[model samples]
Target: MELPEWHGPTDDAELDAIERKAFADSAALQLHLSNKSRIHDGVILEQEATEGAKSNQNHIALKDNGCGEFHRLRTRRLPDWSLLKRSCNEHRTKVKYPAIKFGGQIVYSRTALEAEKATNELLRLIKSNTHAHSGNEPFPMGLDIEWKPTFRRGERPRKAAVIQICVSRSHCFVMHIIHSGIPPLLRSLLEDNSFVKVGVGITNDATKMFKDHNINIGALEELSSLANLKLGGTAINWGLGSLTESLTSMELEKPYKIRCGNWEVNVLSKEQLLYAATDAYVSWYLHQILKRIPENSCGDEKPNQANAIA
Candidate 1:
């Protein structure tokens, strides 16, 4: 597998600032380990190539610089997240009757022509918003991707099945990648730096896009990074679920069920469409909230009540 390029801070001043700030945080060690793992993995791959041996997708063979022999590096497996699930009965009083209320319409495009039309409208929105003077102004686009689950161990990861883009709170376009692939207009928007793309853990999604379709996603900003920058020492690397719950006090109901659903199918179920669209829409919503917080507040400021979604 080709390792993704590290696209984080590159400028010396920015890197120094990030390093200084991150070093003061308790979670900084974890961040350093994550970056180190990427670098170490890249080095192992390079060594394998120099030795005229192809690296296995399932395992990494690293040559001991001191010794001439190569050894198989043990890959770290994450803990079973399913074991940590809480029973709904434990918090029956807290649960809402109808859990999620997404005030958005998910537009599914199964054909290329239909997908192209949606992409065109999205491009128009991006172009119209180019004249905004404020750097902190909310970008009109929120992006997210979904794919089929890989159950068996040692199996290659699946390609992205759906690329969901939310142009507005009430309007989302789901591009059926398995059926229609990425439209040229959509690709153009993704590659344009002036058009801001907001999402959580977006680098992983961008890597998949490049690996599967050779499409480069430009002008992308990870919401997690933004949150860290804004919150400073108090920041936690929260995923979509935690981030949404923290900011909006809303639960993303049955995300796992919809995530593992049959995304490769020709026609997606209403639940699948809603789940994908809501994920994208929430990213945009969170971006709006985060951007509104004053830069000097240092995690002390709450989101503006008027701007909060019901």
Candidate 2:
């Protein structure tokens, strides 16, 4: 018999149905095994059990027979993710804490001239922001990238469409790179060793940028790694939104629709612009906050203070 191919059922009802079927199949199999154990010859059953135990020694067959079924069940039993998302929203609504907002002048560039100007402006900001004594220390610029997401099976990933960079609390630049190819000045700024691009999973972002634009990013600072080094207790992987909330006690309003929207559009909507800007701004702001915390301070001990993003 041919195994069923998964087409990525994402809806709650479909997930529920799949989970029910998997459970029923497991129950039936268990009942069949119990009946066979009672009716079959003991010697034959023992031999079969011994063979099954031996199969565990073969990684390939073990994965095929054991881990495969385990993953299928685990995948099928996934919780209603939509419900969890709704609950998070509801929690924010109940708490009445304001969502993270960007208080900055946003520059959206779609032409080479505009991109170059933005790049120059970013360099100026870096110059003004860094101290003279901080020579050769890469100025941390909050960075993020977005692309048109693919939902269809076997679809090739679209090249990155947007690149956002925030240098100060008052300014952010969003480049529609998919429209305006990375210009020489913009490329130089990205490759400049004096600036450190900061974000979550920035290595992956750098890799994707290099793949799509052939422009290699220079220095990168992963916020998770920074947080691990600064904060006390066991280290944990940190996502941008979660880290923001952990540090600032504010929701980073990431509406699913806007987040997963088409970044390749000719002009971004107001919501998308804000979303992009706020992400970069928060990254920069969080870095400042983490930097202020002493190296030996336990984050859990000063929850009240740590939660406040100056």
Candidate 3:
């Protein structure tokens, strides 16, 4: 029997209906199984389970020999970070970058070693300048990520190509994740509570980092969250672009074409470097301005010293 060709379903209900229908039709079930690879078998099984539960059935018939249990177990297993790191390292090749100007100087970390060195230098600066002081002062660090754009439909999302951490206005360390995964020293700083990792949409970044690279980004201070708290009932979720404009009174230069450029490639264009650096730099700049505002100015009746990090 010739079964109808399936397009993508519109929603979970539609998908469930389709799955339920397919389960009753052998030809349609085979066609669905043929289109989806073995890796997607878990999704199929999950749909089957959902259908079964709705019908008050304990089990669903899998025409595929007894591999249902195995598939379920495999689906629950998370991707091993060590294996992923090794795989990336094996394919890793050194990439060069043209220095882009930041804080009155051209800056870029071309290699993993250079990135690590820059991170160390930034830590030293943080220790001497910020940490040395005694008070509830937060050591503010700007954080951002760059990823390759997905050009086609149904393509797997790209991993974070590079991660930029700006500890000081004059210094931004652009760590090449494809070339070198997050270094140990940098990881320490990221997890440290004393260092406030400030970014506009950092929750999404943190989720991606943990999901893709298995790196837990602690000490996150989301600027958007801070803005909401400061504004007191103003429903404003400002992105880096708009926030920078409002805070600094200067437009941030983020070209659309450059923003969508292939960040996973071996060599990064000068524009990409500048764009990544400026994002983190702006985050750092905005954090500085936001932290300095008195509690009363933001409509906080009580001085919340807990928000003050020092």
Candidate 4:
């Protein structure tokens, strides 16, 4: 599947810095693998790709055959995400590895996933022996937190899905929509100040937190409170996809994005879960980078208190 490409202005230094930091402090970095090996081997310990990538409803091939993620429909590929994928192995990949191309992706059976586990284990061995990349922290305390959202299946759909959550330990954090009635608890926990809840489109999360999870945080608290606190919300609204594009010049895979898939399936395939995880992680990860920089050095850091009702 074709992974979405964000074409926004990107400074190599910024990306390099984040990558260095991610591997330095992240569990994945601790594992010691190149970006590709990690995903193929360790990052996705429980998931495997199944199904080729396809177009998200937002995706549309232009007359020129070019696709658009915002103005038109989003493109998708069950394509492997090596852009951020990593592995601990330094051994040469077999002839078929790095088998990434643009397509929806072939679906896999649970049994097929077993094969992946074996491969990851081997890669882990290599990571264990590899030397460190520059800027690799022994045990940094950070994560990237990106997210992708979705709506509840078999319902009216007003309560959209915001299930994507990736944290950048350096690159991002691991994430989930978890709109399952726990938002208030998270918010109450955050009131302690040290709790430090961060997000890209946190307001959207907060609204869903209340709508789907009865968060009671209200629109203002969900959206503006963090901005008022000057913790998040700069020129962008924390739309992970938009922010990633703005920051990384990396447009993420958008296919199957607006398309409703079987999210509630009791047993989600590894590929499906990873797709969900990546979306959430990227958004959250972006801010983790922001928090490390001196506030004034970054762009307009908005008040976290000015939230809007969903």
Best by TM-score: 2
Better of 2 and 3 by TM-score: 2
lDDT string, candidate 2, 1-310, tens digits? 0112113212334323433343333333332332111101001111133334432121111112211232211111101110111221121122332576776578888888889888888788877877632455678889999998887879999999999999876688889899999999999889987788999899999999999999899999999888777654445556686666555545676676787789999988877887888888888777766665545344222223323221
lDDT of each: 0.58, 0.64, 0.56, 0.33
Range of the 10 consecutive residues with the lowest summed lDDT in candidate 2: 74-83
- Using alpha carbons, what is the TM-score of model 3? 0.60
Q: What is the TM-score of each candidate against the true structure?
A: 0.63, 0.66, 0.60, 0.38
lDDT-best of 3 and 4: 3
What are the per-residue Cα lDDT tens digits for candidate 1 across 1-310? 0112222212334323323332232122332222111112212111132354433333445644221335655422211110112332231123232233345456678777878887876666656655653666445478889888777779998898899887554467788888888778778878877667888988889989999888998878889878666545434445776555434435555555677777899788777777787788778767865665544233334333343222
| Candidate 4 deviant stretches above 4 angstroms | 1-155, 158-193, 216-238, 257-259, 294-310
The local lDDT score (0 to 100) that residue 49 gets in candidate 2 is: 37
Could you say which candidate leads in lDDT?
A: 2
Better of 2 and 4 by lDDT: 2
- In the range 113-200, model 3's lDDT, one tens digit per residue, is 7667767777777877774444786677889998987757799999988898776644566677777777787777777788778998
Q: Give the TM-score of candidate 2.
A: 0.66
Q: Which regions of candidate 1 fall more than 4 Å away from where they truly are?
A: 1-100, 127-140, 296-310
Worst 10 residues of 1 by lDDT: 76-85
Q: Is 3 or 4 the stronger prediction by TM-score?
A: 3
